[model samples]
Structure formats: C-alpha cells, structure tokens
Target chain A: MDAMPKWADVVLIPLISLILAAILSALVILAIGESPTKALMLMIDGALGSTYGWGYTLYYATNFIFTGLAVSIAFHARMFNIGGEGQAMIGGLGVALVCLFIPWPHWSLALLGGTIAAALFGAAWAAIPAFLQAKRGSHIVITTIMFNFIAAALLNYLLIGALKPKGSMEPATGKFPEATHLPNMHEVLAPFGIEFSKAAPANISFFVAILACFAVWALIWRTKLGYEIRAFGHSESAAKYAGISPTKIIMVSMLISGGLAGMMAINNVQGEAERLVLNAVEGAGFIGIAVALMGRSHPFGVFLAAILFGFLYQGGAELALWTKIPREMIVVIQALVILFTGALDNMVRMPLERMFLAAKRRNKGAA
Target chain B: MELLTILQVLDSTMRLATPLLLACLAGLYSERAGIFDIGLEGKMLAAAFLSAAVAYTTGSAWIGLLAGIAASLGLSAIHGLASITFRGNQLISGVAINFLAAGLTVVVSQSWFGQGGRTPQLAGSARFEPITLPFAEALRDIPVLGPIYYELISGHTALVYIALLLVPVTWWVLYSTRFGLRMRAVGENPAAVDTAGVSVVGLRYAAVIICGVLCGIAGAYLATALQAGFVKDMSAGRGYIALAALIFAKWRPWYALYACLLFGFLQALALRPDVIEGVLGFKVNGQLLDVLPYILTVIILAGFVGKAIPPRAGGEPYVKER
Candidate 1:
C-alpha cells in the first residue's frame, strides 16, 4: 500500500466529500418541490452578498471558531469533549454575572472581566469529566454528553429562578449595563472611514475569534505542551513511558478546550444578544465536531470549516424565511455533510488513494 | 409512605421503565456483539413517528407496531452497513444516524401529515389499551397481593409485559445459547471467533437487527401506549439515558432491568414533584429533579458506584488482517 500525498490528503478528500454532500442536499431540496439552483443562489446571496450578509455570517463564524477550536484541542489529546455545549452555557452565566454585578468604567475592562469569568466557568464544567477519564477510567464521551444535559437543566433553573428580570415572563436575564456593551463592526470600522452594516451583530469578538485561531495554531504546532498533548493522543502507553502524566495532560488539554468553548459566550451573549438567553449556545457545540473533523483537527482547517457552517446557518435561515423549504431541511443537509466528511470518509479516500498509487506506480515503472 | 402511595409509585415506575428497559436490552445485544449503538434514540424517534403515522392512517395499532419495527430495522441496517461493511468509526456513524433521524422524522412528518412535524392523534382501537388479566378483578381483594397484582402489574399495556419478559430471554440467549456464545466471543475477541469459523459479520448484523426490533417496540410503546400521537424530537434523549443505564448495568441483562427501574423511579418522582413535595414536606426544584438522571449517569460512568468494563472490541470495526 502507498501513502497519499500531503496535498491530496489535506485538500482533495474534503473538497470532494463536500461536493458530494452539496449534490445530495440539492436533491433533497428538489424533492421538496423547490429549485435547487435557485436555493443555492439565495443561500450565497443571503450569506455573502453584502456587508449585512457578511456581518451575520461572521458573527456565526465567530461562535463556531471558538467551539471548533475547543473540539480540535481536545481531539489532539485524544479526548472527545462533547460538554462544549454545557461549558458554553455555563460560560454565558459567567458573562451575565460579570456584566450584571460589576460596574465597569469602559467596555474594554468589562470584556477582560467577562473573558476570565467565562473561561473559569467553562473550565470548571469540563474539569469533572477530565478527572473521571484520567483517574476513574470513565469514558469522556459518555460523561461529557451527560454533562451537556445537566448544564442545560442548570441554566434553565437559574434563568427562571434567579436570573430573570423582575416580573418578566420570558426565561432570560435583564440586559447588561450600557457600559458593558461591545462595539459592533459598524462602529469599529466607521472610524477608518469604512461603511459597514449597522444592524449586524458582528462585533469585536470576531477579531478575538481570529486571534484565537493564531494562538491555537502556535500552541498546537510550536509549543512543548502541544507536542506532549499530541504525543499522548497518538500513543498513551508511549507517552507514559516518556514520563508524560496522562492525568496532567488530560486535565490541562480539557481545561484549555473548555475555556475556549466558554469564550464563545462573549460573542453571543455580550456581543449579540446583550443578555443571557436560554439557548445562547444553539447547537454550535455539536456542529463543532463536524467542523473539527472536516478541518482535519487543524487550526486553519477549523477556521475555514467554521465559516462554511456559519454560511449554512445564516443561509439556512434565509431559505426557511423565503421559501417553502422547512428549517429542518438544513439539519438534514448538515447531517449529510457530516456523514460524508466524517463517517463515510473512506468511501472517497480509498478510491482517490488507489488512483494516486496507480499513477505513482506507472511513473516509477517508466523511470 | 402509605401502602397505596407505594403501589401508585411502583405502577408509575413500571410505565416509565418500559421504554428504557426495551432500549437498554436492545443496546445489550448490539454492544455484546462488539457494535456500539448510540443511535438508539434516533431509531426510537424514527419508529415512534412511523408507528403513529401508520396507526393514524390504518386505524390499527398492530400494523403500526409492525411498521415501526420495520423502520427501526431499516436504520439498524444502515448502521450495520457503515460500521460493519464500510468499517467506519462506530461513534461517528451513530452520531450521523442520530442527526439523520432527527431531521428525517421532522421532514417526513411535515410532508405526510402536514401538521408541522406531528402526527394526528390516534383514538379508540388505534391506540394501545391496558390488558386486564383473567383473574385481576378477583385477585384485587387479596390484601397484600391485591395491589401488587391489580395496581402494580396487571393493568399496564402489553408492551410493558413484553419488555419485562425480554430480560430473562436476553439472559438465557446470551449465556445458554450457541449463538449467544458466539456473539459474546465476537465482542470479547473477534479474532478468536473468526478462527473458530463463526462469521463475525453475521453475528454482529444479527445483533444489530435485534437491537432495531427492540428499539422499535420501545418507540411504539412511547407513541401508542404512553401518548396518542408522535411529536417532533419525541425520543427526547431517552436513548442516551438508556445507553447510560446499560453502562450502569455493566452490560448484563438482569441488571439492566434494575437500572431502568431506578431511572424510571427517578423520572416518576420528577414528573410529580408536587406529590413528592407534599409527601416529603420539602419543596424540590423541578429542574434539579430533571438533572438527577444525567448526574447519576456521570457518576456511574466515573465508577463512583462500580466499575464499568466495556466489551474489548465494542467500538472497533472488525477487520481481518493478513
């Protein structure tokens, strides 16, 4: 057997799988009595046409970037932290508390306060599952999944009982103080004489998400901690022999992952909603698994995958609003993409690898 | 607690535990054959929707049951194909199935019923009725045994009995039957089973198919016996709960019964928090009650109560290496 080239493995496989998923999605749309091509056009236009579209897309991308990076970091440690959903929910609680109680003179200082609070809350949520996996031999997947439900229940209890505004029927907290409000893209860009969409929710958190990508890239590829994490993931016994404590590595990687996931609260809660909503996470944590898989668990890959999903989410909303297509259809489309890219990946890879290997053999014979 | 109150709680426990028992047993078969099936929720959801739709259309609960079983088996086949034939990652395949079922159930429900991801309510014979035992009335006056027979056991739907019966059957088959030995061996060491000339793929597919059938019954019970119609996302994380119960049971059939009942008891308490608070004279938060099962699941997974050892090859796809 011959190995696939780096370019083909990294680029070609996912590209083809994505195309396959797109075709299947088109077929589903057509079956629902809609024009597939027209749907595609609407999706592109609604998600990427102008500053408004880009604003929503970037806002969603920001959320995905945090979650996708969280999943990718854990994947490097051979851990599946499905509790990102729960961690983010708790992180939102942290942000809400910070914005509610503390009096910040400026948004910058508030942002710093909210970030630390969110990270600590999220890491605390993840620490239990990490400890279980390391010391108790419990499966991280099961424990983390259970934590997601528990987190939802906890958030629900808090919002309705302790966090709700006075005499409000809705299960949400009061808006943050005006000083805690983050500047949106329109406000940020206007100073440079650049016009942007005012109503768009994309804020300074988008830049923070981008910065996170760079930080994650450096941490994974250029740092000793990253090397140890990857080494432990690749071979647990080998890492143990090399004096890398599984308990320490698991705890640290999961804490970092949880913190990153928690940081997504700054984008959705402080930046967009300006309040803690019940469903602030909105399934981004689950979508992060698909993004991480599609991106090959690399920082750059996760960034691109995040944008694509952000487009799907914003575009899917447009489809539901404008057409007969149900909002559930987007979930179907997303599932197909995940199915092809993550589960049935070998269906595409095996054939491509064979073709590449055949070509290499013929070239060698000719030489 | 009064004796009557105890009987009522036990009765509610029976009703609540039915679906969990069925799904947990379903998982037992599949996991014992080295196939990890986290898609039980998806299969149950699919079955619940299909059964309700069919029952509404045909006006026959039996036909609905058959339809639900067939739909569940179809999903199991897909899981088997991905994990067994294509040798894909079992967890990823299970997750995809879950997503597929969630989306497909809603899409199909909207298209078929035009009721916005819900089925029309089944009335009269289209819904399951509690079966009265031959001597239930006469046995109702026997003091200690009266409430036990009439209230706690006798007046439930037929599916509950079937689920209870499956426990012993599952135990017998896994320990006493030839195919059961092969299935266990395949889970523990597929290479050894292969060397013995027993087809690993065949045994696994059989296990998955059985899982599908049981999950189908579980779903049908929820839609028809418990509720009169199917609602979107109706499974509501029950499959994951069942998987947790399976872990808590340590993959044994008899223990699966107790684990499901314990969970069911918790659910019954959570459902009627007012009754519990009145009896215990302590106000309980409904949301905290809801979180108990999940928190317990995590505790069990962490081996706080007892260690859980998974089948050696549970998540691995069987590949014959030369």
Candidate 2:
C-alpha cells in the first residue's frame, strides 16, 4: 500500500491529472484531424478571446465552483451525495418563490433572501437522505439516487402547475422582478472599457465562489469540526474511539454539502439568467462530481477545476461556431474527463511519475 | 359497471406488472450472486431500443425480443469486464453504463430513425398480442373470479407468462441446483467459494449475463407488448424499482416476484382511474399518483416491510491468489 503523504494528496493528484488530461486532449485533437497547436490557440482565444467570452467563462465557472465544492465537501466525509441536482433544484425553487412572491425594496436584499432560501431548501432536501442513512443504516448512494428522481418529478410538477409563469406555454416559472436581479457589476465596469457583455453572465458570484473556497479550506484545516469530520471519513470506528460521533458528522457534512449546492442556484437566478428556468442546472450537479474528483476534494483544487471546465464550456461553444464539431462533443469530453478521473487511482499518478523520471535520466545521459 | 371496471383495472395491473417482474428476477440473479446490478435500467433501455428497432425493421416480434436480449447481453458483458475483470467500482461502472446507454441510444436512434427519439411505429404483426386461454375465457363468465381470472391471468402479452414461469425456475436454480449453491456462496463470500474450488469470476459473469438476458426481455416487453413502440427513457426508473423489489424480497426469487407485482399494481393503479378511486376514495393528481411507486420503493427500502440484508460481499470484486 502507498503511504499517506504529510502535505496533501489533493495538491499533487489534480495537477498531475490536469497535465495528463491536456496531453490526452492533444492526442484526441490530432486523431480528429485537428492541429493540436492551433486547437490550443483556438481554445485559449475562444475562452479569453473577447471580454464577453471571459465574462461568460467566469459566469459558468461560478456555478461549477459552487456545485463542485458541494460535492467535494461531501466526498471529504466519504459520502457520495448524488442528490446535488435535487438540492440545486430545490434551491432554484426557493429562489423562484422568493423572486415571485416576496416584495423586495432592493436587489441586494432580494438576492440574499433568495440565496438563503435556496440554501435552506436544499439542506432540507438533502436532510431526508442523510437522516435515512444515519438512522436506518440505509445506503446513501441508493437513497440519494431515488431522491434525485423524486426531486425531478416534484420540480416538474411545480414548474408546470403552481409556479408556471403566466401565459407561458413553456414549463417554467415566471421571470424575477427587475429589482430582484443581481446587479450587473459588468455594466458598472463597462464604462472603464472592462467589456462586460462579453462576460456572458458575470456577476459578484465569482467573489462568493472564491470566498467559499477559502472558507472550505479553513474549515478542513483549521477547525476541530473539520478534524472530527475528517477522522470519521478516514475510519468510522477510529473516529468513534476518538470520541467523535460519526452519525452527527455524516449528517452535518451532508447538510453543509447540500446547502452549498443551494447557494449555487443563486448564480443561476441572480447572476446568470436572472430568473428561475426549467433545466437551469443542466447536469451541472453531475458534472460537479467530475470537478470534485479532479480537484481531489480540495476547495482550491475545486476552484481550479471549475475554471478549467468553464474554459472547456466556452471553448466548446466557440469550436461549434467556428468548426464542424458539435457542441455536444464538449459533453463527450467532459465524460471522458470523469472516466479518466475516476480511474485515476489505477492509471494516472505512478505511471506519469515514472515517465517523468525516465525523461530526466535521458536528459542527464545526453548532458 | 363498477365490477367491470375493477376487472379491467385488474387486467391492466398484471400487464403493467409483467415487465417489472421480469426485470426484478433479472436483478435477483445478479444481486444474489454478489453483483450490484444497478445497470438494469441501462440494459433495459438498450434492449428496448434494439428490440423496437429490429422489430420495426423485420416485422417480427420474436426476432425483436431476441435482438433485445442479445443487445442486453452484449452491454452486460461490458459491465462484467469492468467490474469482474478490471475490479472497477460496481456503482461507478453501473452509473457509467447508464450514462453511456442513455446517450448512445439517443445518438444512434437519431442517426437511424431521423425522429427526435422515437423509432417508426411497430406493425401489428411485430407486436405481442394478448394471449387468450380457453379456461380463462370460460372462467370470465363467472361473476367476480371470472373477471379476476381474465384480468390477472388472461389478456396479458406473452412476456407476462414468461415472467410468471421464471419464478419457479428461479426458485429451483437458487435452491436445488449446484450452480445456484455456488452463486449464493459467491455472493456471501467469494473467497470461501474460491476456496471450495469454484471459479468466482466465471460464476459472477454468468449471473450478470443472465441478468442482461432478463432485462432484455423486460425491455422488449416494454416496447412491443406494453406500448408497441419505444420512447426515450421509457424504462423511466423501472429498473430501479425492480432493484428495490429485489431488496424487499430479501433476494428470494419467489418473494421478489410478489414485490415486483405489488409495485406493478401501484403503477397500474396510478394510471387507472377506477383503481385509484377505489383505493384512495377520491380523485388524486396524476402526477402524485405517478410518484406512488417510487415513494413505496423508498418506504420499503426504509424498512416499512422488514429489514433488508444484502449479500455480504455484493459490491466487492473478487480476486484469488494462487
């Protein structure tokens, strides 16, 4: 068995995977009759080509970071919270209700209220599975998956029936009031030649995502609660012996994870679309698993991974516009990333290290 | 009129329950052999697609069913390779298979049929027509039991009979046969089975493949018998419901059939107005009724019926040292 490192496995694994993923993507590009050099340049150009593109990338990355962190936090406690999609949906519902029903005097208060409502709703949604797992010894994976279905059905009903926008044929709720929309920071910055529309859906959510990352890092490294959670994750029996309640940690961890997912909905409602819409999350919760895995459950790593995915999203759209590749190819690429990441334990780390050492030796011989 | 309606409801219940019964039996075999076969949904989806595609092309229901089984077996072989050979995580592999099947079927179907999702409507000759037994016809003349007989036994497509027949065969293989003993042993503990000189991988592969075949039949039944055409995601988590039935039945084949039937009854009731009125005593939202089967699944899983004891080493891959 490999020994645990003193620093952090999270720091090393993701960096290695990213580099390996880049190399693999290069090969894929080559096989598809695309020049790797031009593809790289195009991707960079598309992602950062214009200010609007950069804004859009950041806007997308904001949601990815929130949901990715939500998954990563649960992963740290050795729990697979597959219900992130459900939680995010509940959050979106909360935001929609607040935006539609609650009368807010200002946008900031509306945004805060909507976000908090989302978090609370998401936590409540997740709490059911956590309770079942903790109290009844029901497996979390199976229960969460079931809950995901229930949530989807419930959302569908709500969107089409009670929450349906007036006079709209689409199965979606009404748009939020202008007062409830997240203030366009991009608009404010545009006069300074900041180029905001190119930013897609950019808002203050990016700062919140960064702050959330730091908070996650501090919670994991600097607090007693984090220690107990980590201990329980490592070994339930050992954690119990150390006077920590494994059940409590599991429940709390799930709630926190789910709450974060709810917060991600704010990015959609307040930041991006400025209204609750059908299929708003759009598999971001599932893709969050890939992000969390690629990040190795670290907050900072999740932040970086989310940005990489954002780049992929933006570049993929650009590729579709400029080249023959379908936009769905990005989904294929994302799936491949998850497949590689899941199997990373078996394939990525040691082999790459060995190859790197071999290259160093060849260089030394030449010298 | 009320009695006639009840009989019609009963008849529909059995028809609806048939696919779940077949899929549950499929889940039972693989899970009993210690493989967590959550890919039942994917297998069923693939089989449904393949069966519909073939039946639509060849104008033969039998050939369509066979094609479905073949497709399921091929997909299950991939699952076997990943979980049994590569020792990959069963849950992850299952999830991956579901994603791959969902996307691949849609992609291919779009390429072939040129429709958004659906294939061409199957012809009458390419669909499973209701089987009418002489006894059931004669019995239907009787008052209550006649309707019950007609509803429960007669008028179902051929797959329902196949599913009901499978229960006895499953019981026999699980209890009396040497392969059944080996499968049970492997599920409980592969190391012990290996120590007893049985090939764990071979046994697991067989169980999973059998599961695939059953799921294929179930899928074909859904397409040809249940609806006479394929719809995207028509399986619609029925596979998961089958899995829940497997657990609720304590992994017993006979008990699993009943569990599946109960869920099937719920599904049929959800769709049938008379049964819903009789049971709930009032009209309910169709959407709420649609959620009843899943809610029941969760409740059963939460120990509403009894405790669920899974195979000891169900999700773990088996490795042997020489």
Candidate 3:
C-alpha cells in the first residue's frame, strides 16, 4: 500500500515541484528588477496565443520529444546516458551526409535515408560506452560523459576540415538541396482547409515524434525486452538469477536510446535548418535529462514535459525580445526545474506522503 | 624535438596541470567520504566567474580568491542539502548544479557587467603575475638543469606551487591522520564508522566542504592566474577530465598527481600541433590530441589497461539500518 494514490504520485508531485520552481524563478526575476506577473503574461501570450507562436513552440517540442524519449529509454534500464548531446550532434552529421550525398529525387525518400543514417550513427557513438560498461564494470555515467567530449572534438575536426563547403567562411555545410525540403505546417494543413503560419519551422517531424512517443510506450509496457530491462534496473543480481543478461539489456537499450536521440536531427537539422551548422544541437540534448526526470521516464509524460519545455524555449526568446531579461534566463529556470524535480524530489514527497497518510487515518477513524 | 622546445612544453604542462590537479584533489576528498560529486566543474565554474567578477571590480586577486571559495562553498552546501540531508540522487544533484552554475554565472555577469556575459580584462594587481623564484637569474647560466629549473619550475604564478604542494599534504592527511582514517572508513563502510560512534554526516559534510574549497582555488587559478579574466565556459571540460583523472589514479593521491600531469602534457601538446608534425614527420589533428584523455580514460575504464575500481560505497547514500 502506498501513502499517496497513483494520480497524486504522477500529477500532484510534479505540479507542486513545478510551482516551487516557478516561485523561485519569480524571485530571480524580482532580483533582476523585473515584474514576474508581466513576464508570465508575456510567456503565455508568446507561446500559446496563436498559430504562429504554436508553430515555434511545437517545433522546439519536436526536438525535445526525440531526446526525451532517448533519455527515458536509457533511464528505464537504469543507465545514465548523458551523452545525448554528442549523439545528436553526430546524428546531425548523418542527416547532412544523407541529404548532401544521396541526391534524393523526393523529400520523402530523403527523409527515409536521413532517419536510417541518423539512427545508425547515433547508435554507433553510444555502442562504445555501452560495451565498456557491460564488459568491464566501467561506470556508465563517467564513460558516457567522456564520450560527449570526444564526440565534440571529433565533430569540431570534421567541421573545420571535410564538412565545410568550399570557400565558405562558416564552419558549416552548404545549404541542402531543395529536393530534400520537408513540408512545414502551412503546407501540410493547407490541403485540409486549415491555416498555419508559413514562416514556422514545425514540420512533418512533429507527427513522427508523436508516433515515437506511442512506440516507446508500447516498447516499455508490452515487450519482453522492456521487462528484462526493468528487471535489470531493479536489481542486477535478481535479474541475473531470473535469466536476464545484463549485457544484452544494456547494449540494446542504449543503442535504442542513442538512435532516438540521433533521430532528433530530422526536426532540427533536416526539417528546420536545412543545412548542418556547427551548433545544431544547441543544448537540446542536455535538456533531455530535465525532461525525462520531470516526466518520470514515461512516454506520454515525456510528451507533455517536452511541450512544456518547448513553451519555455519559445517564451524565453519572447521574454528576451520584449524585456531587458537575457536569453539565459531560461537556463536558470531549467536548472531550478531539474534541481526540484530530480534532486530535491523527496523534499516535496516526504511531506506530501505524511499528509496523505494522516488524512487516510482520519477517514479510517471516522468509519 | 629540440631541448628548448621540449622545455617549453614541459613548462606549459606544469601550468596546465595545476587546475586539473586541484580539481582532481577536490573530487578525491568528496568521493573519498562516499559523496560522489560530478559537479566539480560547476563549482569551479561558479568560483571562476565570481573570482573574476570580484577581482575586476575590486582590483585585488587575494580578495577574489576568498570570494571564489565562498561561492563554491555555497554550491557545496546545496549539494549537501539535496544528497546528504534529503538522500536524493547524487548524480542528479550534480547535474543540476552544473546547469545552475552554467546559467546563473552568465545571467549575473550580463546583469552586472553588461559586456555580453564577460568581465573586463583584469590588469595591474587584479591578476596573478608569474613570479621569478629567488636566484633564478643566477641559476639560469649553469646548465640544462639550470635552464629547466629557472624556466620551467620558477616562472609559474604562486597558485601552481600551492597546487603542487597540496599533493603531498593530501597524501599525508589521508594516510597519517585519525580523521583521515575515519573519512576513509565512512566511504567504505559507514556502518562501521557509525557503530564506532563517529558522526557519518559530519565527516561527509567536512569532506564536501573541503572539496568545495579546493575547487574554489582551482577556479581562481584558472581565471586570475592562468588567464587575465573569466570567459564564459572558460573552464571548458576540465572538470570532467579531472573526474576521469580521479578514476585513472585509482583514488590514490600520488597517482592523481601523475595522472593530472600526463593529461596536462597531452593538452599542452595538443595546443602546439606543429611540434608533433616537426618531430614525428606527419601531420596530426589537434582535436585528436584534445580527445586523447577521454579515449584513454575509456580504455582504462574498460580494463584493457589496469582496472580502475572506485571505493565500494562511492555513489550510494549511506542509510542507517536501525
């Protein structure tokens, strides 16, 4: 028997944590001499007021969905895969290569090629750390963190050398060919007698991200592999006794996690940028950690959390534009969110559980 | 390579190794007491920014060092609140601290200085100038040994020597003292320490606070001694590399010094790509050298080299069974 009901565990806790984070963020704004109420109004208006704002919000959400699902998959296996940033960077490289070299005759075909390439490249980057962790008892957290730096260095070298376009001053590939352009919201909604902002970057990848959420849901709750992964996570010794191979679970889940993280490229690099730049990932990979923690590593929960972060990203930009607040304000808010939801969770949970238990005892006495 | 060229690289190696050594020792103290800290980078970053910001404003590097230590101590207290008092996820707490420092430093800098999140270039007494050891000029004409001593060992800021000095002090404290024994026991078997009537929480907090102080010094060295002022994310990934060095050293103080120096040498070599090409007759990418520490750490971790085992109670929060 639990002290609190399931709904409260899932919904109430997160709400309280979010409220705490918001209160602190408000204090921060006040410290900077800004009006928290005005900031809140502006955030809501810029992020959810109209189709134009929704487009940008959803576009950022697409990136978070892939990365969040990626982190969530690894979390289920009890593996801390902090290298999502590097994997996404390499995934962008894969997208760039597929689009630039394949010369696809149609956008659909190019999307297919890009997806496969991104997943494979991302999986390859994750494989080394996974292998080391499984075979040698190496700490996955440390190994993955190391991989992030190595991947960055590798990407830097490539950007400066082979990846840069001829005579280009920027350390980025040339603009992708027109044939590989993904359809934005405006084009997709027009045939249905609906309107969307044409300037918005939200594209077909948004649907793919939704599909991924469902797929991840099924994979975690309805598969033998998922069971084994969770079993290993709960108790490695017990899982071994139950005939589950830790190595297989570790390798499979990390590869999938890396693949999902890599697949974020479809939205950012292929769908939005249309050309691979040096900073394509833009810290969205690290944002996955906060999302997975807040969502409790559930796919549907991740979907909601991703959107929340998307709103924060777009609204933060709006705040920067309309007020004196700097763009890094969003990062401060993110830190508070992660701190409250992930690290100090018990700070909320302990008190909530006691209150619920007290209320339950009162009802029993009354009965 | 020529002797002069090699000497120069070694000199740079000493300078580069100081921060790694300081940060690695910070990790050693914290993890030794069973509190795993992945936030050394963040604490160092916060310290670096505060140290630079204060130094630039006040024009005294000494005051900057104190401010830096205070800043790092504040973050350490937060980590203690979350992981020690609340028994939350240590790694998660660490990640949060990293992000907090990364974000808060920039926001504060932008609000305070308004130079796009940067402090003004420190000058005069605000920065640590390289010191000329006594008799260095007199010793410079003796021989190869003289040049090496005068050029490589005598020209670093005082912080470098302080970092090197701490290595032996750390060894003596960890091996030769009663508090050191209790700290080590707390990390490996907190139950035993508890049964013996020592306060596990107190020892762990002390270790964490020590870690913070070392990290503060490391950041101060980076901004005030090595560079004129702080740049955003100027510590780069040195905190992570220092963590790697901790593992590579197998949690021993002397081995940590060696690991840091080797990693620092690699960084020094990476900065001079021409030296590799001139000596080895082939061009090598500086990025590869930049990545070598992480790669080598991975390989060592995989046990392809010697095994690097952490302390048994390293990442687990100690719980009283009663």
Tens-digit lDDT string for candidate 2 (B1-322):
4877766666777887788889899988898888897789989998999999999999999999999999899879877876787676677667656655665565456556857667889878799998987698778778878877777667778888999899999999999999999999999989989888889999999999999999999999999989878888789888888877787788898888788778777777777775677777988777676666666667766776777878998888887863
For each candidate, what is the lDDT? 0.90, 0.80, 0.92
Error at A152, model 1, angstroms: 0.9
User: Ignoring the other chain, what TM-score does chain B have in each prediction?
Assistant: 0.97, 0.94, 0.99
Alpha-carbon RMSD to native, per candidate: 1.7, 4.3, 1.4
Whose TM-score is greatest here? 3
Error of 1 at A317 (Å): 0.8
Output the worst ten-in-a-row residue range by lDDT, candidate 2 chain A: A1-10
Encode model 3's per-residue lDDT on B198-287: one tens digit a residue: 999999999999999999999999999999998888889999999999999988999999999999999999988889899999988888
Ranking by TM-score: 3, 1, 2
TM-score (chain B) for model 3? 0.99
Q: Which segments of candidate 3 are over 4 A away from where they belong?
A: none
Q: Candidate 1 deviates by what RMSD?
A: 1.7
TM-score of each: 0.97, 0.87, 0.98
Candidate that would win on DockQ: 3
The list of candidate 2 runs beyond 4 A from truth reads A1-56, A164-171, A188-192, A311-335, A343-367, B134-151, B278-281, B319-322
Q: Score candidate 1 by TM-score against the native.
A: 0.97
